[model samples]
Target: MSGGVDSAVAAARAAEAGHDVTGVHLALSANPQSFRTGARGCCTVEDSRDARRAADVIGIPFYVWDLADRFRQDVVEDFVAEYAAGRTPNPCLRCNEKIKFAALLDKALALGFDAVCTGHYARILTRADGSRELHRSADMAKDQSYVLGVLDERQLAHAMFPLGDTDTTKADIRAEAERRGLAVAAKPDSHDICFIADGDTQGFLAKRLGQAEGAIVDETGARVGTHTGAYGFTIGQRKGLRIGTPAPDGKPRYVLDISPVDNTVTVGPAQALDVTELTAIRPRWCGAEPAGPATYTAQTRAHGDDVPVTAELRDGELRVTFTAPVRGIAPGQAVVLYDGTRVVGSATIAGTDRTGRPVTV
Candidate 1:
């Protein structure tokens, strides 16, 4: 359990279903106090206590596993390195893939548990042919299928999402918790990245990578402004450029790219952000075969619009071709594919053709 209303209620629901349930809380950080502060975040000692209380109320055993070493190596290090490489990384997806599903699931199976359950707003469906598939939750606004799409067949087979079928809003969850007299009934949702307490990505990177002043240049490579660090900027960013000069067309300029080699942040017109095709690397298949080329919907970011796309396997990598142009398709982000509600697969975005090169479209 995550020590939140959703997970707490999920545990209660699972126990109500008459299954042998055990609550497992992951201690990902070295300092437990950092995870329990005010109304935000998890993985703290207090949150663990809350999770244990919820499990006790539901008449189940609860345990806290120390996964700090693995979490740092898998999620935290990957996040830091991705930013250093000038790509925007989704640490949550990495956590789901490496820590939760891979490590924790393995441990759960070893402990003789039938399946590991969580409060993630996604569903796992067993088809008529006995094949498992991942689907979006009933609540569209709380759908987290994009991040959970990274799970492979093995992980999906041993996973259970208790809150998937229930279309409960945040308010409904809080009300349910209160009705049940759960300890976390009034506990606030954990927002922002859990590991990073301060919510300052730029400041964190600067401390890790040291202060590296660089030039913020336009498309023509002319230095228009200066920034304290290149890791602070991301592609398609319009704010924080701190450029004193106005655009020639009297319009706002947007970040088109970040060249780590040159240590330059490239600014250009908004048109430069549009892309029709993107190359996704490190493809992961969830309960499906690697069928050659197939049509599916691809979502680049969480809460972003899903675009009609054609996915093809080329030289072992999945390349997605969007029917229309998409903006803000950043590298290191997960591009999740879905056939209606079932998640086909997902991959890390490697690059894009922002220049609008015409192909066989």
Candidate 2:
């Protein structure tokens, strides 16, 4: 249930629909006290208690599954490694792909469960041939299909989203929770990266990857400033450069690239962030893979705008050419392609083509 209102109501609805539902709260953190509490945090000790209470009110079985080691090996470690390699990763996607759907679903099936149901704002549509496809939730504002883009066809077959088809808003879900006597009806939703208790990402990275002094240079390869570590910066970042010398044109500079090999942070004008084409690997399709090159809307980041793009999967790489220049696209972030509201697939960005030159990260 994640100790949230959405999951509580989802459990209630699934059980009320005559399906035997069990609420499973993942104890992701080995030491819950190290995790944050209140609205900004999830999977904390308090969240587990809240989930149990909600299960009690809904008259269902509740269990807290300890997946801390798996989570650390998969999501947390992957996140740190990606950052250390100067790439930005989506930890939520990894958790959904490896921990929840893979580990949890496998365990549930061993215990004779049909599927793993959650409060995710996405839908699973079955074709006439019994093939399943993942689609966006009816509530586009609350849509989370981007994060779930990592799920393949096998995972979709055994996934359930009780609140996907509903057109109601998040507020309505909370109201439904109140009507059902769920204690988390008015609970605040968790935000940001849950594991980082203080919400200071730079500080967290510093703890794992000890600071290594690096030079921050401009487009001309001229040193502009210095930083504690190259891992602390990301593409398109404008603030915290601490550059003593201002640009000759008096314009602000943005992070154009992070070269971990030389441990250098390159800063340049904002236009340098514009990218027309990018190469992505590790493609995960919701249904059948694309047959050929086709036009689709590409979303580069969560809550980011979708742009018209032509994508083709060939030779184990997905090459996406955007009609318009996409800004702030990093190598490790996922590029999810969509046909209208249906997710075609997602791939991890591996490199980008800018000004007819290929830059691999």
Candidate 3:
């Protein structure tokens, strides 16, 4: 239940619908204090207690499964490695792909469970032929299909989202929780990287990767500032550049690229961040992979607007051409394709083609 209002309400609805529901809270951290505590985190000890209380109120079985090692190897370590390699990764997406739907589902199926139901704001539509298609939730403002874009066909078959088809808002969900006597009706929603307790990503990376001094350079290969580590910065970052040399035109500079190989951070004018095309790898489709090039809406960041793009699977990579230039796209993030409100697939961004300037350090 993740000790949240959404999951608690989802469990109640499933049980009330006459399904034998079991609430399972994943213990993703070996040490609870290492992760974010209280309402800001999901894997803390307090969250486990909250889940158990919710299960009690809902009259269902509750268990806390320890998956700390697997989470560390799959999501946590991968996040650090991606940052060290000069890439920005979405850890929530990785957790859904590797931990929730993969590890948890595998164990659940082996235990004779029919499905793993959650409170995610996404829908799965079953076709007449028994095929399933993942779609956005009816509540468009709270749609989470982007994070769940890694689910394949088999995963979709055994997945259940009790709240996806409802048009109610988050506040309505909280009200439902209160009506159902769920203790977490007013609990604050979790945000940011849960593992990082204080939300300082740069400090967290520095602790593990260590601080190695590097140069910050502009597009023309001129040194502008210095940084403790190249991994601390992300694409399109404007603040914290600490550039001593102001632009000759008195304009502000933005981070255009991060080169881990050269240990340099590249900054330039905002327009230099424009990207025309992108190449993405590790594509995972909700159903069968597309056979040819097709036009679809591409969403890069979570909660970001979707833009029209032509995507093709060539040489085992997703090649996407945007109708309008996209800025702040970085290597290692995901590009989720959508046809209307249905999620087509998602791929990890490997590289991008800029419009006017090079991304090299």
Candidate 4:
């Protein structure tokens, strides 16, 4: 259990369903419980206590599993490496892919458990043919299927999301938690990156990446400003350029690219961020691949609009074309495709058609 209202209620619901349920709180750090300072974050010492209390209320055995070494090696390091390479990563997705489903679920099966259940807001649909498919939650606003696009058939088969049904809203979950006497029922939701305790992503990167000064150039390659590090900037960022002078066209400029190898940041007009096509690498299908250049709704970022798109799979890569224009398409971000509510597939954005083409200022 995650020690939040959602997971606490998930355990209650599962236990009510008459299955043999046991609560396992993941200790994702090496430090002991005394070291954590009641931070408003997941996996803190306080959260473990909450999970244990919730498990007690639910009448289930609880245990804290120490997976600190594995998490640091997998999720934390991958987040740092992706930023160092001038690419943004969804560390939550990494945690779900590597630590939760792959590691935790695998160990659960080894210990004779049928499935691993959580509070993620995504549904699992099982076809009559006995194949399991991941689908968007009935609550579209709370849907998290995009982040879970990394799961494959094996992982999906052993996964269960107890809070995915349409009738079960966040309010209902909290109400259930309160009815069951869980202390986290009314607790505030945890936001921001958990590992980023201070919530300063740029400052954290600066400490690790260590100030590689880079020239901030416009589309014409003329030096317009300077940045402490190329990795600090991301595609489509309009703020924090700190340019001393106004643009010649009196229009707003946006980040077009970041070249970590050359240590340079390129800025251009907002129109430059627009694109109609994308090339995605490392495509992962939940099950078998579809037949043709099929049409599906595509999402580029979390909480972003889902646009109509037609995509074709070629040798494990995807050539995706949006029916309308998309802005700020960044490499290393996942592009998830959906056929109605069901997840069609997902891939890491590799490049764009205009990757090397400059946006003329």
Best by lDDT: 3
lDDT of 3: 0.92
Each model's TM-score? Answer: 0.96, 0.98, 0.98, 0.95
Which is superior by lDDT, 2 or 4? 2
What's the TM for model 1?
A: 0.96
Off by over 4 Å in 2: none
Query: Which tens-of-lDDT digit does each residue in 66-139 have in candidate 2?
Result: 99999999999999999999898899989999999999999999999999999999988899999998888999
In angstroms, the error of model 1 at 245 is: 2.0
Root-mean-square deviation of every model: 2.3, 1.0, 1.2, 2.4
lDDT of 4 by residue, 228-320 (tens): 988788888999999866789999899888888889888999878887888888888888888879999999997788999999987778988
Q: Candidate 1 overall Cα lDDT vs. reference?
A: 0.85
The local lDDT score (0 to 100) that residue 33 gets in candidate 1 is 73
Query: Candidate 1 — worst ten consecutive residues by lDDT sum?
Result: 352-361
What ranking emerges by lDDT with the best candidate at the front?
Answer: 3, 2, 1, 4
Tens digits of per-residue lDDT for model 1 on 21-75?
8888999998867653765777767788889899888888888999999999999
lDDT of 1 at 328: 73
- Quick one: how many clashes does candidate 2 have? 0
